[model samples]
Target: MAQAKKQSSIKVKVQKFGTALSGMIMPNIGAIIAWGLTAAFFMYPHGWFPNKEINNLVNPMLRFLLPLLIGYTGGKMVDDDRGAVAGAIGTLGVIVGTDQPMFLGAMIMGPLSAWLLKKLDQVFQDKIKSGFEMIYNNFSLGILGMIMAIFAYFIIGPVMEVGSQWASAGVNAIIRVHLLPLANIIIEPAKVLFLNNAIGNGILVPLGIQQAAQVGKSVLFLMESNPGPGLGILLAFTLFGKGKSKSSAPGAAIIEFFGGVHEIYFPYVLMKPSLILAAIGGGVTGTFLFTTLGGGLKAAASPGSILAILLVSAKDAYFGNIVGVLGAAVVSFIIAAIILKHDKSTGEDLDAKQKEMQAMKAESKGQAMPEAEDAHESVKSYENVKKVIFACDAGMGSSAMGASLLRDKFKKAGIDVSVTNTAVRNLKDEDGLLVVTQEELADRSLQKTPHAMHVAVGNFLSSPKYDTIVASFKALTQVEDKPKQEKPVKKVGSIDGIDFSKVKEVNFIRHDQHLGTATMATSLFSDAMKKAGKTTPVKAVRINELTDDPSHLVIVTPAANKNLAVRYSDIQTLVVKNLLQDKKLNEAVEKLN
Candidate 1:
């Protein structure tokens, strides 16, 4: 029983670690897409290309807001304000690290930094419990956070600047020298596969905006200049679509091509991943066709659909645009039909299986209808009578910020409300809770409070969306409660080798000592330790290097040093237990009282 329990606990821990790591990685997906779009649009300006205006508009927004959003989401997941702050700071590092725009680097860096910080917190949490709290509660987290910001600005910024210039020059040289034709060939498929995003924002928008200045001429010009991938997809549908699918193809094509909604054809291609290859082939052919025909537009393409290109292209290029669109369509149709014809049986099977799964899900949902209703009713009633608690993964950063924002909105509207930030699992029935979180976290809290109304506020805390919801709450209620007590400060423990008599705070440094990142860890740990508030400065030594002094506390990885400090009876028993787990750090500090 004991072994099974231990395994179960470890499994949960591992799963939590994985989730946190994934959370750090996934939110940047949108930002990366945005960056790709911005980059392509800046470099290309034909109806099929991007332009300078797009770069200017998109760059600043993506650079600042993308990381902010990622950091906000990441922090909400952990429910740590400090971690969220760290994520934002780290994203800045990545922006500085990459050759692409700041947004792209941040998309990569935000999560990396969040994960690094989380790991660091996990390792040295026990060692610097009081210091972490002190820094966080006293705004030292902000100061340290700025240090990371400066590091990115000075160090990572210069490196990326030099690297990106070199890379761009190299790519330009290769395209010009060895791969001119190949570049055109690559452009279409790349546009379809990778450059589609660029085409939409980079090529389409600037052109559209420019055209907006002379609406009729711009719209007409665009129509003939750059019929993009949508035209190809439409052609594919017209040629290869069968039965009811054929009837739907025209609408999908129209929407994707002219309506400038490229997403219209995603479902069709998804139904057949092989269609992607055909699409890519068609895209390559179409790109070459357009380039050869001298089809060009003045601005960026919005959706890179046939209609959008025609609307934004110059009048002189209209005939060329039409030819390019038709050529792409013909090529795509032939390719799709040939490939799809060979896989009819697979398509049918996929359709049948999809239907079966849908039916099964419906049946299961029907069976559980009553339970779901009961849960909903229970939560609604609880919210009406109990204190409303707001939660995220981390209790501090985004959640606290969100909670404060909501509280003010509620107050302004004269709604009686008590809002506090807390970890999702800490929510109780007495504390009627509404979890405002990124869509990804809805499941985590919803499972425990099945009836709770989960507002899928994707990074709502940062945007005005949070305020909007609070206003709604205010409209519904008129009662208000007095402010809650401030969270109490946690006291530091007296370890033998560590001198707390002169030290008022502790600093934790985290690194994978077993791996080669040890030196980096040492530096970070030493710097953090040095920043601890003390009447007298103290030197830090590694856990393995520590002598067996009764006054010294050894800091090491949790896996290897679990038993080391656990044996000390005089070391505050409560603090030791709190530091044993990473998630419990704040609670552990609270326990010190």
Candidate 2:
């Protein structure tokens, strides 16, 4: 047990580090895609239609714009807007002396520079005079940015270039040994463990960008982003798995293959850990085919969707890329099928496994398992929520898809709230914000935005949590839009006929079918009475349990009141339209002794 905990701790540390690395690159994927399209369609000789004017964007974007944006974002992740400027300033230092894109350097300098500035401010900020604050802030940032830039230009740039070369050399060595495909042994498992962003955006993308700069295309972009293996696993579940896992696989497959939300299929693998072997087999097969057929992509596919893969595919490598995805799918499906066929378990309880997976995921992110018991405990938090954000490890993939779905739901329901998607690291703590994230990422989301209400979903595509959010907001809009009356009408004679001074105990009679409602109504009314400073006791009991006494006040429906009148003549009763919400019942609680 101790060893297991130690290993889990190490995994969490690695995941956190990876998440930080990916947080820098993932937000700038759009810029990366723009550079890729320019390179693929307009670069001289290699591009489909070379244009010197359009191609001008290719090199500058790769070297200056991309790295600086990454650095700025990385710094923002560490220390907000001030850090972002500092990070960008420091990143320019590395770009000055190198022909290669300094992604690694940007990653290091952006956060480091911002963090340094933040620390410095912590010491001097309180000591600054009130009137000179603006001048101090400006000059401090300027001086620090300048120093960091010079340091990066001289020290970090050349160092990162050598490090980048060594990394490239190591990958080339693996290719020479014909063991490049074996990388799946690590990539496949890392992905299921929710470290996909770290492995893909953080590591593979930078390498792919460097390789593409040299040769116009790189298979490294496809290594971790490939959707084939996950697709295969879903297809196998659709055919051979049992219970909910089997039924949910078809939709999950669509999301994985076409929609590019690979996270939708992770629960299936978690439900059956043995399926990871299939993922490995499929990944190895795909990489081998990609390598053998000279398949390469011009840029990383953010979601790893088949469409995105084809869109960014090198002009000449279409067939190779298609074959690689298909081959991997076929190989993965076969292995998964064999494993499912040989299973001896009665029926896999996917719901339990899913919850277990969520628990494990929460544990890894350094939080206790989330409880549904409190899902509605803080309904008031949703009242002023002006917007909703769907967050995931990488904001571009699963969260984007989930956000789109929720946005549509909100539109149809006439909910005017804004809906958006972003990486969890980018979530901010502010008023009027509601965050929805995958259960695995809930802890991180909470940490980033403790002021915001959070909802964790097991499946992004079709979690009931989305409907709950829609319903809650829909009710809020109705309440807000409702016009008020000039004068409030008080319930007078409805409860005036009852002699509430004689009542010492209030009872809600429970029936076989209505026991739950009766219990809930009694509890609510009890709280309302106490809040009004009444000392009356309240209880829910069976019809036969009521005593024949005026001291017991029975709140019942019209039908139940008739039965109560037949049962006992001395019992006092008030017929209410609703067991819990009737205005008459609320007024009576105020008069209770």
Candidate 3:
């Protein structure tokens, strides 16, 4: 457990950092699109709507506006609005001190600066005298923001500038030698390993910005933003894969290719390691063609959508860029199909995917991978869980799909359980809630919901653990309880007004949420029923899980939801509130008997 916790913590840091970078870019993507359009059109000479004034908005937006907004987002994740202000101010200093836009630096420094202020507030917020609270809050933030701005300017800002020059020179050299395809050797694997955004935002974006600033366009933007490799892998899964992969692959292809959700296809590649070669092939082909054809986007495409690519492309480079993307996809698809077709299934593909996800997650954070037995283990009493939530960096894409998959599994098992997904940061530590997050973000999710149960999966889309997890949910003893609102009437070895023989499953119903008290009460009643010679199965269920099956007995508790009878009109519900009372519990149990 200790080792598992340690490894998960490492994954959290890496995933959270990735999330922070994404937070810096994804939400503010419109700005990226706007800038892309402005650059491709207004900024270029002889281009449509060319205007020197629109060109002026380009550098400032990259260096200041987008970075600051992203910083604000990252800081807000750590604290709130105060962090946002501090994050933006610190990022602003970086923008001022460097010609390079500092995409990665803004993401890191902004969050760090905000985190500092949040920590200060945590330590000093209560210590300040009540009369001076407002003064302290304002002055504290003012001083902290100023200090961070200065630090960013003198330290982070200038350092990133020098680093940017070195990275640009390295990339430029690779481009000049036509060895740009060699980059896919690292890029393809890293993208599948969940570093797609980091590479694009941190390395490629800044390089692209520098090049575009110099020559009005840069192929650097297409390095990882082409989306061709991912689209190819998904297409392969749709055509050549077996089992669930074949069924899920086509829609995944659409979401990834058109929706620009590249992460959707990651698990497909990770499921079959050989598929990485397909990704590499596609990526190399794409990059090589781009370099050969002089294809470059005026700015980053953000989602790597083909449409986004063309929209951001220089007028003459548009067709070439599209061809490169399509060419890469074709190459990747052919390779992936050949690989998946002839390669026999190991039946352990799910395990392989999980290990890959967790292992990459561990390596990214510089930690020892947790033992296989310690990974993706189920929560204690997971069967009794009221709900399962699949969470990711941004709640929208991967999380949503994971939730749907798990929901389907539960439905197939005839289980009525709540399965959902959300952004990790939005999670609340509520009772009986199980949070299933990617191994990379498990620790971050755990920190947010310490009381809630958590399970970390390698890949949300392909983990086989879902079956085991749903089985556990099925195993949670079916039990519920109702409070005693009336007196128990004694009968001769039987409850006077009820027929116990007619019942098979005795369901104890909670009026509100079950925190285990009602279950316990129902258990005591179950024992009492045995004492009274009843052979019926006494089970407990949440109000939410109560079905309209006519054969089962639902014992409703005090203040019980009246909607139960209304919803399950054909079923009989006995109102027995406060079942923990011995007389009432005994009588209730006798009724089940």
Candidate 2 structure, TM-score to reference: 0.73
Q: How many backbone clashes does candidate 2 have?
A: 0
User: What are the per-model numbers of colliding residue pairs?
Assistant: 40, 0, 18
2 or 3, greater by lDDT:
2
Which numbered prediction scores highest in TM-score against the true structure?
A: 2
- The lowest-lDDT stretch of 10 consecutive residues in candidate 2 is 369-378
The residue-level lDDT of candidate 1 at 332 comes to: 67
Off by over 4 Å in 1: 1-84, 90-100, 120-140, 177-240, 258-277, 289-327, 337-350, 353-593
Task: Please state every model's RMSD to the true fold in angstroms.
Answer: 16.2, 17.4, 13.9
Write the residue-wise lDDT of candidate 3 on 1-593 in tens digits: 56765765665576666655666666666776677677777763645788888778876776677778778877776766678788888888888888786776787788899999988977986465323444666689889999999999899988988887887788888889999899889988877766677677656775676687677789988988888888888888777788777877888788777777677877777667788999999999999999999899877887677877877888778767988999999999999999988968843465666666666655644554333234225323553467788887667667888899988888888888888888776786666677888765655776797767667776677666777676565555443445759877743222354455665677766322453566566667767776788787666554545555446666665456365743454455566545567464555664554
Tell me the tens digit of each residue's lDDT in model 2 across 1-593. 45645766676678678999998988899999999999999998689999988888889999999999999999998877788999999999999957778999999999999999999887986575423445566799999999999999999999998998898889878876779999999999888878898999999998899888888899999888888999999999889888767787898898899987778877677667899999999999999999889899999897799999999999988988999999999999999999999977644566566566666655655656433324444454467787788888877778888899999998898888899998876676766778888765666677787767777777777666678787766555445445667775534224755678788888888664675678678778878987999888887666766777778888888878878865665667887888978888778876887
Superposition error at 357 for model 2 (Å): 4.3
lDDT of 1 at 186: 38
Best of the candidates, lDDT: 2
If ranked by lDDT, best first, what sequence of candidates would result?
A: 2, 3, 1
lDDT of each: 0.46, 0.82, 0.73
**Which stretches of model 3 miss by more than 4 angstroms?**
1-13, 44-46, 52-56, 98-105, 154-156, 346-388, 402-420, 425-428, 438-450, 454-593
Q: Candidate 3, 534: how far from true, in Å?
A: 55
* Candidate 3 TM-score versus the reference: 0.67
